[model samples]
Target: MMTQNLLVELLVEELPPKSLKQLGQSFAQLLAASLEAQGLMNQNAVVTAFATPRRLAVHIGNVAAQAADKAITQKLMPVKVGLDAQRQATPPLLKKLASLGADASVVPQLKRELDGKTETLFWDSIATGTSLTDGLQKALQETITQLPISKVMTYQLADGWQSVNFVRPVHALVALHGADIVPINILGLQAGRETQGHRFAAKVNPIALHNADSYAQQLSTEGAVIASFAERRAEITRQLTSAASQEQLTLIDDDALLDEVTALVEHPNVLIGKFDAAFLQVPQECLILTMKANQKYFPLLDAQGKLANKFLLVSNIRPIDPAQVIAGNERVVRSRLADAKFFFDQDRKKTLASRVPELDKVVYHNKLGSQGLRMHYVRAIAKMIGEQLGGDALANQAYEAATLAKADLLTDMVGEFPELQGIMGRYYAQHEGLDDDIALAIEDHYKPRFAGDELPCKPIGVCVALADKLATLVDMFNIGEFPTGDKDPFALRRHALGIIRILLEKKLPLKLDELIQQAIKIINDDAILQQWENSSNSSEGIAVRRMALTLTNHAYIAEEVPVLHKKLQEFIYERLAGSLREQGYTAQEVDAVLGLDPPLPLILKDILKRLVAVRAFAILPEAISLAAANKRVGNILKKAKTEGFDNLSLEELSLHLRSDPQEPAEQKLYNALIDISDITNTALSTDDYVTFLQAQAALKLPIDDFFDYVMVNVEDKVLRNRRLTLLANLHSLMNRIADLSKLAT
Candidate 1:
């Protein structure tokens, strides 16, 4: 057998748990490549790995003893002493070969020109074998430099040496070929028969590993340590499940939490720990978060499906008294619960809505403004959305929700734990007995904190959510927070995505500029709010109502409104286009359809359904001929001077169609024009955009013939004008489906 029983190990400082598995995998690859490079592997070999947070080790068995001798072909000049010009081995070639081992008697040299190069060649097998010692040395040296390092470090392995780079400071290494230690330096430690067991478990001076299998057994016998993560995990689960069964309680499934638990110990021993049942008075989420997030304990669910007030703690070491270990863990969990209760109770002191004014002191962003300012922005846009939806019931609820939506930010509970922003708002609103719609909207404003979560459900909630997100987007835009590629540091993309979901799902009737102006007015505290205060008294409710109304109104109602209103429309259009494409429309179709009406959903819905459906009926000769007519007229107009297109005159239709009924061009043009009114009416009645496209297609053949049969450019001004007028009428009718000529197939 080749010195096959080989064990190799890489010992290092603690490795990141997530990175350890892959690192272990790479070590085996490096070793395999070295073996393959030196041609050392054979059929009987096997390689395996054992990893821990602290070290990665590899073992190979039944390895080859020595490399197989390699065979190579050589081409040498042919020797000729008594050969004819026929090109065969001569007596001189035979004499030279006989000198080696009488092989000349059987061997022959031949001459032939190959690939434009003439050569005489003699074949011989050259066997080169490698010694076990030489091959092992070279393989070890080659692997050292190529080893993957976590961060890259230097550690010396030579006797009385200084430093060299390594993944970590290696405490020791072990490598063996049967009874003898294989000498190789890795991370400042020479490989040998000795390897340590679990650090804390077998902190003995040094442990001797007699052979391959003894490495694991000898260490365990020496100390209560199990280093294999998989084995440790299985043992922990078995114990925890068994313990929970004994108590008639079920354990919650938490794979992610268990992974963290696995990384913490070399030898895992699951122990049941308990705390006062009264502490369960806190909400279950807080209790679980406290145990798992703070204490790393698995919670037990009771027979009634409520939290059992019990926890499972996986320990690295067996304590002298198991009860003492349980007690210590309970104490820590209790302290966390106490803190949670304190914060929860303190939050109940003041109503969340009443605390809104306090947000003025809180900074949202250094450049973006304060939390109070953000509230004004979100509220203004919310009210605007309410008006857009045009329902007094929903609009009223939305107005109230917007004013109180961000009130939780000022609450002590939220301040203590910012993650509880919406949760605290829900709790505080319920405590104050606010309208359920208002309370729900207040809590659900931030419904989708991430993509693919959930959007607000109720109309009031949806409107306010849209308003809040819009205000944030506009403020960021005003401050120049445009996103590029993958880097939306402020999450502008997320805000845009939320806006799209709100519009698409709620299908709200909204004008993008009206919404943006509301957003801008919310943030325009200096411009609009300054004017409102000058003309109105804050104490008078009547003046407040009037000022609120005046704030959202625009002078021209379109042109004189805020610039961000237009910017918002542009943004909404892009987002709408992208969203519709995701819903399975071509990009150009979305642009063409969305372009016909304002994005105010009511207007879009009013016009888009008919327009879209009309396109479907437009497919026959009507649509084809119309598309053709528009294409012809467009091509002619395009080729003509870049000046204005001549306006159509019915006098030309009078001259051509009526004067000469036999004229093919004029006859075809008259028929196509006759269908325009009926075609548009049929498409509109069907409510199918496809019908409209089909109708346009019907016109294609006649339109093509009209342009082909007649000379549109004539020496006489009257005839040319008449043909051009007929073409213009065709373009006007065909454009309803789409600017057919602008479409590129």
Candidate 2:
């Protein structure tokens, strides 16, 4: 009954930088999980993951040398079927027992159990535990098989005849239990205690691990490698901060860049490097992007949050005279900056306005014409949104911005770095000396591109962003390119979420349905529609032509818009609810607010207000009873309506219910409803949901009394209809803000 710690490491060629962290974490977790599943490790075992430029390793504690034996009971067959009339061993039972490595002699010891109506015979035995060597080997194979490798590299082992596929070329494999080597093999390498250390900085060559618990410490001291990804990242962060502070500058923090750098180096040496001040003449965004994306350097920012000439470099080696390393990084970065500056300078020779026509050569989608046609649609939608949000001036700016938005797609800089598409447009726009709003809008149109990202800063940017996203959504959805499950190839979900964020966060008063219709209408226009229909017909350098078709001729857009619009609305609302839930709203609260189906000013901000109001209302003392009563009212009305009751409109439903004295409880409830109706109407008109809900508190008592003393399904047909109308009226009053029935327990 002894336990030991375990260590496992896979030495490999330089792993993929972006995938190293994922590969390491997955390998460690899966290996430990498989061991725990095999009963070799307990649930509470301590597990640590280690990853560097060339290795993935794990150290686990409280792993048993062999898993404990397990008692198992397996049902065989019914007693009557397995045995003859006298209960002697039958051939089938004997064969089954023999197949289980048992004999007829053991038949008398079999247990009897009832399986449904049949009495079944079962065999109970102890399943021998798996030894650590066998368990670890199985777990290691599984871990390697399941690594999250984006692509695999195939290479020959030392034999140069047999091949193995892995994320990188495998060099060695090490597995240790306590202080003893656990014999296992993977990727053509036998597990041993020896592992490679840092390429040039190891204190000891072929570092030999002493024990499972000493892996990380020994690796760091003898290998000159910081094995833990988290620790290495933290150390780099500390170095960057210290270096940045000494120079009175800030490092632009990026987690992705940090992780990649962590994966690229075993020991990080943060050095300060400087570029020519003239590179700042090009937009800071371009320089910063080039430095970080190409060179993995953290650009330092000035006090005003502008990119400084100096940047921080995370070198894998610490040199004796660091000046040469700093110079080398500076030399390499200058060349990259020069390329960015050249692209910027060359792009300015032809203005963004001039590049507009060049977009015709670029296809937006196979079904949706070129970028030119898309911009045309975008301009139209932008003008519409701008006109709705502002007036002629804003509309004009939005139209201008939308027209030039995709021009950067043709630029050399954007061609080299696609991530700079919108950003480079902004620089070119400024070079063209267009209005500040137009230039900013060009870049900001793609804002809030990811979760927690900032939205467009100005009104013009907001208008253009909304228009661009809607155009994409409407056009893609029209072509039956809607997202299914997780396959949002066109990023329709991101576009949808962007639209929702803009509407709610910007507090735009434009109606969601109306905006979608406007977007669809833009696509349905004669020029854009005909161009799209004839787009794919053209070959290289040939003008595609269609027979000047009307909107009806393009059956795709015409047929798809109405259905797509309805779906788009639902998709947006669902995204909103999900976003709200992420912000800590409960499912019930979100459902209550969403259930209201409040119309037109269906602004995201407005929906959020209703959600907040509903959450507050749920805490009131009368909430439970009101919600329950409302649920009852809804069910009764729904059943009556389904049963072919005279289903009147809200106004018509109320007119049929009278305050008849024949039923005193109904009469009392009718009077209370009349009073509550006015208050609810006023509160709803002003969007004061809390006030509307509180106003219904008066009807709770009368409602309870009505339900207690009265039967809604009275035999008289007229009476039943009348009672149904009363309940419908009550249902409408309670649900002005939300479907209270959804909140019922």
Candidate 3:
């Protein structure tokens, strides 16, 4: 069976544990995918990975010893390019092919045959019995080295001139197949059988690897590290729940914090520690973030589910003095809480809205103007959005809230903890005696911080949130700062996504372009223009805003407002296309339909849905035939259009046909075209794409018969032209059914 197993470990100088777990899993998945692509796999082949702060390890079991040998490829082309007028291949070329281990033959061509028309084809299939180790090594080297490094450095080693670049300096690499070596190298480290353990558990010489199994055992016994994050997480959860039970407290479940906590420890030893009860005077959220984000601790709650004045920290190693570690973490956590409390106290001294005027001092972006300016634009935009959503009251409240929202950004609380931007706003707004809707909007503006996050449910919150984001986008467009690849410095992509998600989820009837225009107007208003013009900054801030706005509008190619409209369409189309694909529509189908239709996001979604549903029906053949018939006749009537259905078509169509006219075939095609036109117009009016596509599919039998029986390229030029025109008309109508040309049978 030639079964084998391989273990690989990558040692680095204290990699950020948060990134290491993701890196390890991604690396293993990529390696496994490459193995599968190379057609080398064992039935039971499985891959697993583990990471500590210092190292990432991967173990693959039940792997094949070698990839299967390559198969012979038969080349049907002749060996030589050209010969005599007879087009025969040269004997010398055929002979050369034989020398290269190719089998060659000269005979009559299968596709084309003529007098002395012959060819020689040479094909050689080489068997490649490459080992798993070689494949793994090559794959690992390329894949690992090509990581998207945000922060990294190239180091020239002490003894060698070879410079190696990594996020952190590579110290060692271990690769082994059982006890035998699996030779590989990456980031200048030779893979071997030894891997290190936790930094604190075995500081100097923790790893002494003899094999994979033995190394795993050594990690657990001597280093108190398991390497696997899943194991550590599970163990920590189990131990934490048990400890919390004894203390009669509930462990506050925070999945995001759990991930960070899991990354910080290798062998999770959950331990509880108490802070001074006086710290409970601080806001509960402040205490939680202090413990969670700062200390990587899980906060616990008492029986009443309130903060228990205690926290659980999952230590990587069972410390010789657990109290000392707890005390150190407690001291660190208390410092953060103390700072947070101080900010809160200072911020609460004034009303939240009173902080609004100060936002004018904080530059949202040096090019975009102050945070106060953005809030003004947001207030206007939110009110418009709120009016459209039929939440007039909510919208007014939200606009008020949006104005005060950035007020918190100017506060000491937000300056210290950017993550608490929205949270701080809500607390300060409520303390300032703002309405509930206004206070809620302050917090809800950041509702969908990520893809899976929830949208703002309250109408006022949604309005303000949309306004806040649109204002950001509009300003970016004004200042020429748009998202490029991973550099969404202002997170405009997220803003766009938030808008799309809100509309789709809330089913808001607001037009995307209209919404975008409102924000654009707010930015391009006379007041801002004057402010920008008056600014004495010699760097041409106002001029830059105009250029950026022009560029931003250019993001979309639209028929009316080319750039801005185009961007709106493009964003909607992309989202709809993505959503359609997720529903199982092939990309080509979605694109074809999209191309033929006006780029309205709502209409695009409808068409995509129709395409997806139509795929399930037995209409593929009909669609293909009808489309081909249309293409065949498109040129004939390229200059022609239907005059009117009121006029008698039988004689008119015959008049257009200069060549011989066969009665029934022409009539059939004409009738189908007429029916397709009706279906197209009907779908547009009613938006019933599903039914329209089926009606268009009805042309299958008639199109097939017309093509099979009629001679489109007839000897009579007039009749030929008429036939072409009819077919072209058919193709034109079929497009209304969702760009049938893109559907290939």
Best by TM-score: 2
Q: Score every model by TM-score.
A: 0.65, 0.93, 0.70
Poorest lDDT segment (10 consecutive residues) of candidate 3:
106-115
Mark the regions of model 1 whose C-alpha exceeds 4 Å error after superposition.
Answer: 1-12, 15-52, 56-259, 265-277, 298-324, 511-514, 531-642, 647-687, 690-745
Better of 1 and 2 by lDDT: 2
Q: What number of clashing residue pairs does each candidate have, in the order they appear?
A: 58, 0, 18
> Model 2 over residues 388-440: C-alpha lDDT tens digits?
88899889889989999899999999998999989889888877788889999
Q: What ranking of all candidate models by TM-score puts the best one first? A: 2, 3, 1
Model 3, runs deviating above 4 Å? 1-12, 25-48, 59-208, 245-256, 276-281, 301-306, 319-321, 391-395, 478-487, 527-562, 583-745
Ranking by lDDT: 2, 3, 1
- Where model 2 places Cα greater than 4 Å from the true spot, the runs are 78-95, 527-560, 597-601, 642-660, 711-722
Question: Tens digit of lDDT per residue, candidate 3, span 1-745?
Answer: 5766777777877776667667778767777667666655654577887777777777777666788788665544443442334755456545555665443343332223222555545344566866877887776766676655567888876468789777778888887777777777777777776666666676436466777656667787766787787887787788989998989989988877777777777777888788878878766777787677677888899877789888888887786779888888888877877887788888899887677666666666665556666676678788878777766776677678777777777778777778888888888777777777777888889878997898886888888888887777765654456577778777777777787777767767776766776676665675755663564342354454445545555432232234554564465457656765786777867766665644343422255355654574325556666556555544344443342112224456646543434666667766776666676677658867666667767777777778678876666655655665566556655665555555554
Please identify which of the two predictions, 1 or 3, would achieve the higher TM-score against the true structure: 3
lDDT of each: 0.66, 0.85, 0.68
